[model samples]
Target chain A: MMTLSSLPAVSQAQAPGLPGRAGLGLKHEHFIEVLETSPDIGFFEVHAENYMVAGGPFHHYLGLIREQYPLSLHGVGLSIGGEGRLDRAHLARLSTLIERYQPHSFSEHLAWSSHGPVFLNDLLPLAYDSATLQRVCEHIDQVQSTLKRPMLLENPSTYLQFQRSTLDETDFISEIIRRTGCGLLLDVNNVYVSCINHQRDPQSYLDALPLHAVSEIHLAGFAEDTDSLGDRLLIDDHGAPIDNAVWQLYEKVLAQVGPVPTLIERDNQLPAFSVLLAEAQQAERYLAQVSP
Target chain B: MSLQDDFAAALLAPEQACPDGLFSINGADPASRFAVYRNNVHSSLINALAAAYPVTLQLVGEAFFRAMASLYVQAHPPTSPVMSEYGGALAEFIQGFEPAQSVPYLADIARLERLRVRAYHAADCQALDQQAVLLALQGQADLGTLRLQLQPSLATLNSPYAVVAVWAVHQTEGGLATLNPWHPQGALVLRQGLEVKVFAIDPGSVAFINSLAHGNALGTAVEHALEASTEFDLHQCLTLLISHNTLTHLHLEQKVSP
Candidate 1:
């Protein structure tokens, strides 16, 4: 349940997992397990905020671990689509982390996590209007300029719809990409969750997205819970393993987009490290089918 | 108001409904959908607090702690994206909470737990070497005027109730209830390497550490302790602080390090 430290270095020659497309979310639970097994995975991704500390086991472990595999730092705190301006201090901390480790790719959700000082700690959805689109693009421009790196903005899973929305979700993401020169992290589970919640066809939603701009794919488990009216609400808790429907949706995207860095994220009720690797292996299997 | 601001306000205040111009185009109720955001926000925060203060939750139990945390979150939503800094006001919230008044020591325990959380995430620092400390103080005639640079992660909290004893027993092999008499206690929280630990400290030592924590020199802090308690032991207290690696580096208030 903790990040065990032991990563020294691997051979300069690229390992089987390096430069590959299938990866597992590098959680603390699997740190020791990952080190011991050195599983044949493409890359490992981590939430940037968790490693934002100055120096400790995180940096020590991550330093050696990065040598063995490709790393992608996914951020949950950027709140790019928020109403307020981007937090400069938070941005600086992120930049520091980027400079230190220099992960292969960096990504954040197109959702707001803060209103002024209070951080809601969830990927709250935004109104897909002209104003929000412009604001998000501006924020992206600043982040890219500050970090000196192109970021992949992940699409958020929405449980509710905005009453005064003008732009379609796919159109909004496409516009953000076009305006900011940013890439997309296509989260198949989020597409499944949002589409099922709002009763849109997941295929249509996937088709509308700018698949060419996608650099990474996120597949996670969603909890099928009901809302107040008893209608199903697919909560993206990232608690369980990726489900069958989501896997099929993933395959559909892979069929079109080919292969990218794919991650399996399980944040709560974490199973054994082997279980996650098995899931990651399955994602590899799919990528192999798409490419081979 | 902007749609997001209004939406954020509604989520913060449970009584408030979905913001105006909010809808579910696919026929799902907007209110229900809004509740999803609300639940995500609250449950995530509650989980953060629980993770930071597991001992406190154990002391108060889950159901009661959840209810208390719900009220705490509503009263004080997080002001920053840093989850580590999210629940700083929880100890004070517990102090003001009427239902938790029976376990008056609960707030102090929570405060101790928060200190541990801060220590765990504090910058990794190298502790002061014992030989270096001795060499620095060897020729110094005015030792009392010497200020100490304690580890940034080192902290001391004095409570009217035995907080350290309570925190320790909960972490023991078999968790036992605190049967000790209701006496005042002091705790020294420090990070040894990456792991944060708590030590039960004598009242005089706590006074000395508190003085140093406030930027007082060695002499002044010792005098402050002596005034507070005539039985204050300076040599023993310094030994305690040194042994625990609480004092990382030493400094002279008026001049540079020796």
Candidate 2:
């Protein structure tokens, strides 16, 4: 297995970006509350696809809340890991959104969501072979050049792996960062979920990656089920509170990397704004402890 | 086929076998693991449809809606990544769907709900203010040649069933029993500021608004409405449009002043 240490070290220095604190995924249900209260948060993140519409309440509220909070545009449909070329039209829409908001940070996933013209809407896994690695790097390079900004690539939670894979997941991510010069979003919930499902050590998975390249972090909840063998299966459903085990792994990450910008994402079965804010505050407390 | 080709095919087609080379670290069945992706894709897409068509979901129960939406997802997966833009073909799909025939008006309700979704996200444009509308009406000579530009969010639906009444009843409590779903009705959907409002209008008014939306001049649109119904009231329709801030621009066509 090729280790990250064997590869030539790229500069880990990052340009000034999102503050080293915690943020929450801005939900439409909480737009009015956010505007009225103007909560003290590190920033607010939103799904780029949700705001792709030309104009509407989504844009209207986002424009208002953006004035007060630093915004991160997280994209879910870029298909950065697909075998085919990137979707030009979707890329154009993303460009338009970036131009409009000028968000502090932009991120997409390592998983593929679309095949050809049909979008599956779920973040599907990839075989970490040389061919898949090259395709993913090319796609990331295209996105960076088109948007004229370095994007953060997120790690995905997978239920299955392919026998054809030639590289470890961490090694593939390390090479992609080395090749394309993009930063890592470092979704901690995904780390916990994938590690548990695959029977790997979460700490070892984190240590193998180029931690210096991490620019942001995501913490979310997962739904638990069992596989055909009745072993534990973790689904990255983002429908509940962050698991205690994931939080422990996150603290370990902060201890190593010293507080990257973190986001609390709750996409399904959303609770009140106060509940999400409280979770963000909990992350902030951990971040405060690790602050230099 | 390529890896993604095989994977995507199986994701949408539940009957197909899981793609080759997939394995779980715990030695679990690949097919069961793959079922997670299948369930996510189908349920999420179905949920998007259900979100866009709440009334349609209510008219039919959840189980029926999910089953119908699952078939719709397999038949017509989203072309665009924007989930908001997904399920535009659903109204047309429901029309030919064999099971949906029991609720014959289900397709029209779907159509209205889709229009509301579109209106909610349409481009924002400043509507012609009341003063501008008044000034344009004052120019009697230009009235015949006046062309009214509707808001991008404005849409019309003419249904053989009382789609507007049925939809309106769903907004409140206990009114569904009072609605006569068999009566033909027309609807006008427009965004008043941020809120998308749907109003029940007469069929002739639908014809008039549709004509105006097609860029027909005032005189021509009135004639179209009159042809649709002898009792078509131009004043009432004009009031509805102006009050709802539907007209964005009033243009007077320039011809040789003969």
Candidate 3:
């Protein structure tokens, strides 16, 4: 058999242009369709953990995709918000992937998904205390220095809150950006979900955000599961189309911060490629109206 | 305990109260708010396990698999964020699970599935240079010191039960043939290009492959294979491994100083 190693390395050396106004989370199911059509979009975002493999179909398809569209490496596993020290092995893998992909924007959540050896496989919430804040800042600093590039921290849609948190979620994110000099990935869906779950105002929450630091934005669908009191609890499941409320919130964010590299994320029950592209086109239309 | 620890534990178990210093806004119930996380954590992990071990889930039926997965998540949460790399211990957990004691081959099936997932993600490497191997085998090229390297994705599943047949039958929609649990079966998991495949082999091939996998010289591995089975065919096994591209690199013996 021919050597498989040489097939991908040659092309991975060249860098694609950075993403523009709108992109979508590239799923494996849509790889073939994407290659066939080559739809119009700013870029495609892939989970850094999925492509952590040595080499194979993942890289093969990614190589083909990277040749055409700009790429963004979005990480869900870093657990930057945790009190535990960052996993050096995981960080090493991330560094290698960044060097290989050279994605336009490298972003991870402002949430903890791991504690010790146990990986919960979810973007978990954290208490925004001074100690936690310091821990998060140190982790971000390490990640930025190790990656040799400024990273963007995505705000997560949390279900619970900690009374110990003296800082509001926005202030807490702002403080991290201030200390680490990292950019922000403002997810409109997360803002709407966190506010609805906490009975806080979404507009006011967006108003307090460090939008200037926001280099990217994410818009995804959320699930509406009821709480014990029969109240709606928004879960950021990313299984459906962007809701009308979230779209309006995206409009508000665009009105405030103008255009940013926004992504339409749909992880589960993925629709046809055309569906995602249309949503991305919608984002482009909204972004077009802005005076950036 | 710290708030993070309590919060982590509470997500797994609902009987445990919300973490210290947790409160709901607008007088909403904190437990109700916290339940969202409990739902997300358990369901997402359960879904991931279900996706990885669909055959196991299929064999035991969805209802039982869900319960087993729920219990497994509580007993052992993931230590790494690679969801595909998670659930390495599910097969072990299933062996002790009370409700799953009936299907004795269930754990092995889970193991077979796990190995396939690992092979799918394992590192890529080039296959053995067949021309050099042919030349070395044809000549009297110090067989005692000839070393072989298999692909990193290669694995062997040695089981007392007919696991390969049991797994194969489950792959299609058809009649459920009787699988003799006492029948010994050995299967070699191979990866070609991008996909992984499992092939049932005889006891001798398993013995020879096991020896080679542990870095034994071809001559030593052949001896072990002969000991395992009188009719061991070293040439045929070599041909099979080379054909399947399981053996990636070969190292012939060097000339020793007189």
Best by DockQ: 2
TM-score, chain B, each candidate: 0.92, 0.97, 0.91
lDDT of 3 by residue, B161-195 (tens): 78888888888897575656568787788778887
lDDT of 3: 0.83
Interface RMSD computed for candidate 2 is what?
0.6
Better of 1 and 2 by lDDT: 2
Model 2 lDDT on a 0 to 1 scale:
0.91
lDDT of 1: 0.83
lDDT of each: 0.83, 0.91, 0.83
> Which structure among the candidates has the greatest lDDT?
2
Candidates ranked by TM-score:
2, 1, 3
Off by over 4 Å in 2: A1-14, B256-258
- Per-model TM-score on C-alpha atoms: 0.92, 0.97, 0.92
Error of 3 at B72 (Å): 1.7
Q: What's the true lDDT of residue B244 in model 1?
A: 65
10 residues in a row with least lDDT, candidate 3 chain A? A6-15
